[model samples]
Target: MNLEEYIKENTATFDAFLQDFLSINLTNHSAKLLEAMNYSLLNGGKRIRPLLVMAFAQNLDIKKEYYMNVALAVEFVHTYSLIHDDIMDDDDFRRGQLATHKKFDIPTAMLAGNSLLTWAFQILSDESTHPNTEVRNYLTGFLSSSSGHTGLAYGQSLDLEYQFGNKNADYKKILKMHDLKTARLFKFCTRAPFVLCNPKILLNNKKTEHLDIFGTNFGLIFQATDDLLDYRDLDKSVDLGNIMSYKNNDEVVNYCKKLAKEALASLKNLEIDSQVLTELIQFIIIRKS
Candidate 1:
């Protein structure tokens, strides 16, 4: 299948898998929290992180049901970030629908986000996620560190700092924030599969290092393009993160192209097929929503 078709088919399959995996019952006392969590998780998204997980796994020739645990874990963390981010950014809409905080109460949204974040580790800790206990432990620790205080959370802290005018939006600080807030998770997406499968060639520090580089640059490209789109569809109240605030529209676009080139170069160094990943770069640059 072509890249677009491949994405669509895989996305459909993943969504179905995610729905069944959640399998929440509404009769419980915490039903509202469950509903809010489900709403945020199943809400419209590009599913780019999970797609990366699946694509890398497939390219490694290690496709298996356990890989879905990795994919879902990544997405759960991502979704949790978005829900909490919306509340912090005071965004009323998410994916063209009401934000979780708006649809549910702020406390409910907060709990939902917390649950999703914790749920990611819970999923990874399950023996079903990996037969090897060491592998499961590694996955859990990797995910936690990536999304924890030194990673995505740290990035968001930087973003909020800049947003409230507490810090100047210099190019260096902006880039650092982008790396933390956005690219760190992408790093997880790219590196997790190799670590998951424990493939010899990919498992080496040097090779997985390149994958981490690719994921970071790829995520920067995604974030840069998103900034461009935000400029196109500028909302007066919402901050466009730091990129737009630091660089002009044309400069941001050029930086995106540069990041794509760097990311593709990293992919070229890897043993996997990169056709879909290359197309994904183009897709990110051209996507409207």
Candidate 2:
């Protein structure tokens, strides 16, 4: 299948959805900060986290609108993290645009980052965002915990330590840092819809645990692919972890693609609409960035 075609199609639709959602012009104190927050959030990326949310929700039989708020909110959290990350790492570019801190200022970026963080939860908690309280509650809690200290924040700590630590760090330890810093939220993005839509299906409902396993495995594979992408840049600027001395990104990416295939293999037995998601897994594995 043409995985690039699949992702390009879906991302077009998803980007439009994000624009429409942002049209709401929702606000809180610190209007300028909120504007900066919107600037970064709307600034482009692969939109992988949000896409995973939508893709998995579709598998669960939920449509685009049903998951739009959750997906958009997920993107918000992601953009906020990237903003502060660029500031902390002192990197100057993101997705080929000026890093948030540089585009604005350090303090402004910090407030803007905080602005997006709160807004993400606001979208989840907004009564109008979801049709049912149960779904809303599950999403709110899941996203919160994942982006909180237990996941993204702690991961950031690990990443900072590694930047100053060693380029040739143990592979296993590097994996841990990537997981907390990069994978945890990815884990959240892929699993949230399934869990929110049907916790029982995952936890105790014997009806379909395979999908849960599929999502978890899929998450791991996606995380690895992301790490591989960062390492692809020989300069290692986009990459947080110190990688092998340059020139082996091809081997690394191929290995990651293999892992992705294994993850998709786990879904072969699940009963769900996986047409796009199946393609998505492969697309992520092979994507350039």
The top-ranked prediction according to TM-score is 1
How much lDDT does candidate 1 score? 0.85
C-alpha lDDT score of every prediction, in listed order:
0.85, 0.71
Clashing pairs in 1: none
lDDT per residue as tens, model 2, 77-139: 888898988999898988888988888899999998898888888888887666778777877
Backbone clashes, candidate 2: 0
Which runs in model 1 stand beyond 4 Å of their true positions?
24-30, 199-203, 235-241
Candidate 1 Cα deviation (angstroms), residue 208: 1.9
lDDT of 1 by residue, 160-274 (tens): 9887866567778888988989999999888888877783545477787779888998888887777677777867556655677767777887888888887788788886567
Q: How does each model score on TM-score?
A: 0.93, 0.84
